[model samples]
Target: KSQEFLPPDEALEDPAQIAPGDWTLEQRRPWTGYAPPYAPDLNALETQVARFRRGDSLLVVGAFEPQEEEQPETDTRRQSMNPRIVDVRSRRNESRGERQARSNPFGRIQEEPVPFLPEEPEKTAPVQSGLFLIDTETGTHHEVLGEGPRGAFQLLVPNGRYIIGVEAFSPDDKRAWRDRHGLWQDPLVLGLAAVSDLLILKGGGNLPESLDEALPTAMPVTRIRTGESFKAAWELYGLRIGESASVRIGVDRGGEGFIRRLGQFLRVLEPDAPVVMTYEDTGPDVLGTVFRAVELNLPDLEPGEYTLTVEIELSGREPMVIARPIVIVP
Candidate 1:
């Protein structure tokens, strides 16, 4: 009955030529050499439909046919199913120094590591509202009360060097001292005077003896004085960020000798006095007194203290170095 449903040409077609859809058992019977000994089982139709749903379509002619038996399993004890494991902990634990020593057994032993010490915090005096005097030589501190109007204060002590600083507390609890600019006096050397009005404090004694002799013994009455002395002074502008900050170095007496030796060369040092900016001729300015001023360009610098040094070279003598300290703020 199923063969009648197919066209006569399809029924009579060679089994290979027939479409898989029409290649029923009756059509494949001529190509297959074997025949079923039992009658067709109608109950197996459900099983065949389930197999087809499971992707086992009956289009393949001998797909379900029995295959030849596989060869017996071989026993090969010499072969390994997994890779061999290695314990490299000992080798990895070896230190670099040990490895180097192993490579060169006759080499000298490496130096022992140095112990590190934590940095100590800086100690600053607490801020207070009063007149405070610090003995620069002995580090002794003294505070005194104010006297008359304007909160005026006075201190009378034995002749010694002192650092006078005023401490004021801000609303935010921040303490600031009067150490900025030239407010703090240098070492004051007091001596006995016959008259109460006579008081003299030495200055510029720290200058190099050779450079000091080059200075004029007497001041010139005229505005313009001439000598071989070299004098450098630093003028500091504002230290705030984005502000005009610069250092003006005035070379008065020895302009010609300075130009001939240094040629406007200058060096900038860090607060620690280490040379950061090497010697570079900033070019010469023969205008009045041959003053050479360098703009600090404070915008690019971090907020901190810095030192600027000017080295004045001499033909047959060691260079005389002068340094000025400046601060920057954000």
Candidate 2:
């Protein structure tokens, strides 16, 4: 499971677990406004497998090193490939067949070709290729012939994380994609890892922005340049036209917090502070919901991944926060 293989702090129970990273692959949770176009098909699935094989596309998920109690991925292949394996779906089908045979006077049961189901899985026997969603909590899975879970944390995942199980269809992958649509059921195999730290995703600006601004250009702000100036626009709610609110746009280094006290003692160090924009909202209510657009000038920063957070707080209410992960490059 991701919790077991990923770093210890990435676990849900771990207080150090930070925000979810960019999980924009395979439309698991596309924020695009598609009146819902496209359905899972042999072609798309196969193409994805090939992409992962050739290292063209990337998938994002979680995993941590082993904790005290759990041994992640130990003898998993041997367990899944064991010659003897029984499953609930197959047993249910067999039970239904027996009932039908008992109803017939001659007691003859004819074998029927099983229909491919999107969610109702059959048996878990190893195959050359397949796609599955492994529910870590339940230790059960259903075939992903259609829609799958969309989100990083998958908070909807009961008691555990969700692991994507993608078996490669190599050596004529296209044909194999179509051939192994519903046969493979064992999800105890397959994988990928977080490459955000290694690669910068430049083409992810199409997703809807948290701040509602009628943009003049389509800039890929997901990749921010260190020490460059940029502008941000956002709408604030619950504040009257003349009411005061505090607005701030800041970059976070996550758990790698700086030792400010030590830096403060050294004037030469300048007490390392993040690039922050603070706004004094003295009832700056523009159009109904308080709106403000400010040009932000970023300070020199080390090239790495950081979270750009935009927060607005009214005097007596909870502050509305929206953030995006940005990869700072040289």
Candidate 3:
């Protein structure tokens, strides 16, 4: 029972041993020491069980980009029996470790000095860019974040049901998706946000194109200096000519104010003196969008967080309200 470390080329449990755990100490050499697993090759597969580390709520995904200049030829070729049925192991992956350097005649060279790691990831064509988590149920795209310079991207997301897919690509391939001005080169995204159910952008993403008329501009107003007046334009659909409605637009506490107001509508809560603007469909007889823009010139107030609340009440239908958070600074 006074056995110690055994040398290589000898099994710990020899077939001819007289008894279990009864190896003679003379059989083991004095200088032999423990030997760890040879050149550890760690492999991993993303599974549903592995992804949800945050108590069943998958918060985010951390993705890795491949080496840009990987030469698949240099990798030691591997041969295995081809199974009739293909599975996870048969899928192709060109990603690899550092490039092979010249046999260092002067002993083992440090990995830092040689041109080992590739400049960018995914050598072939740049793979894909941008990280998005689409909700599996509703298909709502959440936390669309761009990659950083060093080929890593991240997004902190709220708890939700999602099918996680995270990947990245090389740097030279940036021009294909982005135009010369570095803007996303997709013309279909031009549709107004309201018309597209927040798909494209409401107007165009700037100031309302028409100031006085019923026109919503792409101009988005999120922050404004105190003592300055900001205006917004909105569009409403399905209205007959001469149909009248009331609109109330004002500032309230920011953040959760939208949810609070929304709940109020469910429970039928109405304030006594809301800043209401009367809107009457004066367009043609056909049902079309009624566009209108508003300018606010309120007296000075303390600078802080607020939500621009817009409530529209039709003749008989339930009121429709939308609130956007804004910040005021001195």
Q: Candidates' TM-scores?
A: 0.20, 0.34, 0.38
Q: Taking the tens digit of each residue's C-alpha lDDT, what string does model 2 give over 215-250?
A: 222232245677665554444433445767676667
lDDT of 3 by residue, 160-243 (tens): 444333323233342211100000111112222221111001222244433122112222224556766666555555555666
List the candidates ranked by lDDT, beginning with the highest: 3, 2, 1
Error of 3 at 188 (Å): 22
Local error of candidate 2 at residue 5 (angstroms): 18
> Which portions of model 1 miss their true places by more than 4 Å?
1-160, 169-295, 298-305, 314-318, 322-330
lDDT, residue 306, model 1: 41
User: What C-alpha lDDT, on a 0 to 100 scale, does residue 203 get in candidate 2?
Assistant: 31
Candidate 2, residue 163: Cα displacement in angstroms equals 16
Higher TM-score: candidate 1 or 3?
3
Taking the tens digit of each residue's C-alpha lDDT, what string does model 1 give over 232-317? 22211111222221222322222223332343223322244343333333322221112122222223435554433544433333
Q: What's the lDDT for all of these models?
A: 0.25, 0.33, 0.35
**Clashing pairs in model 2, backbone N/Cα/C closer than 3 A:** 5-63, 5-64, 5-65, 6-63, 6-64, 6-65, 7-64, 242-283, 243-283
